[model samples]
Target: MMKKVRVERDKQGFWTHPQLPEWDESTTFADSKKWFSEKGLDCALVIMDGDLGEQWGNGEIDSCLAWEPEINIQDAYLVGIWDTEDGVVAMFAFPQIILEDSDKAAEFKTDISGWVSSDGRFYGKDERLARYAGSTHRKCDCGNIIPKNSYCNPCAEKRTKEKFLAMPVVAWDGASYIYDENTDKYFSNPEELVEHYAVDDLDSSSAMLIVCKPNYARQIEDDFWCDDLPEDISFDECGGVEQETISLLNKLNEKLKTTVLSYSPGDQRLDQSLLF
Candidate 1:
């Protein structure tokens, strides 16, 4: 007679060998698939000893038992072969089923075990067997990957400064300008600019108002008024006035009640104007 197998179950569902830990039967099959797939193996199986199998086997005293054709035993057997080869004898009881009129079979002890089959060989529950069972796919930028939430550390600071400069302005005068919630003070030269605020502290303000000559202002927007006059405030050729320089002087005049004077290069000239 073919060796009849037995099955058994514990309060937790199934009894396994003392050395072999019990796993949730529902997730066990899915985990087995993943375990095998990661290892690039063909199939996976789980087995238990007959002593552990009695718990799952039906209590029937029969010599010949009708095996369920629907239950795929091939994969289980393949896994069993691997387990047996690995010296895990407990795996044999994994698929124990009762036979009809097998009284002696019911008396056999059944225990739980697990196994996997790959390359025509069976293997026991070894860490190496399930090491690479799953695909390691990673998502793109928006996903939960490192350094994708914002610009990298170095770029983040520069981006933050650019964004801060784009904010709307509240008010700006000849001496100081206010943007967003920060204030910036103007200085006549780079030396004065550095003296009032340290280089590192400059980033604390939203903007810096630098006073420059009209010629310099041509290239860049004038953030504040410069007390110094243009080289040729009066248009000698036009005699009457120079429209561009006069317009710039008028704007500065409106902001500050003072006279405008033309200071030639390399010439020391100082003049004061009184407003009515």
Candidate 2:
């Protein structure tokens, strides 16, 4: 690992780079790339979300860095910054081209996995590296070992399907109930029974009279399946409402009302209230 590079901003919103003082907060990504190109480093930008690096000291914000593909250069460059016991620290790391010789550059590229340090040294593991590493095994956001990139296998597939085909399934992997495509069933992710229900065709905003008509609520409560739900009771059908779901909606509505109370009726009011 190398030492960390330092970055700081003055009171005037001017960001400073210890290694690359010529570049600052005002510097655009294109300008930075051009600067790196002038310095003979064929680099690309790698912007990682702060959450991914939070476990390592990086703030939960977006961090951008220039990734050099041809690392054969002599000078190591500033990578990014992270928080330390003292304060925010800038870091640096070597690219494959600079670290390895021509014969080993390819192998280095294959195994180029490392973390960022404020002292400008490469640490252990990094999510950004793992994403491009093309490794067979990956860890999901839920801490489960997955087979694909950032998310678990099923999650990745579900996300792809949802994005590509606009699937109506609401992914509830973080919730108590998780959908299982294997058996077309729902499973309890919780350790014990929590008195939850799976609602079907329950529209929250509509507030239709039929919802309170006869034994509709009772039928819904009665048909609530903890393990699995019927096919008709999906996001596409609506009308689903569990006890907690209803409570959440009520709370949300109350909060919305309170928020509306604080603001003027027209949309133009937001322009006055919110900061640009």
Error of 2 at 251 (Å): 49
Candidate 2: tens digits of C-alpha lDDT, residues 96-184 = 22221122112223354654332233434653442334233434666664334334556666674454333332222233333323223
Q: Encode model 1's per-residue lDDT on 122-147: one tens digit a residue.
A: 23454233222211222233433221
Among all windows of 10 consecutive residues in model 2, the one with the lowest summed lDDT is: 207-216
State each model's CA lDDT, in order: 0.32, 0.36
- Using lDDT, give the best candidate's number: 2
State how far residue 155 of model 1 sits from its true place (Å).
3.5
Angstrom error of the Cα, residue 42, model 1: value is: 34
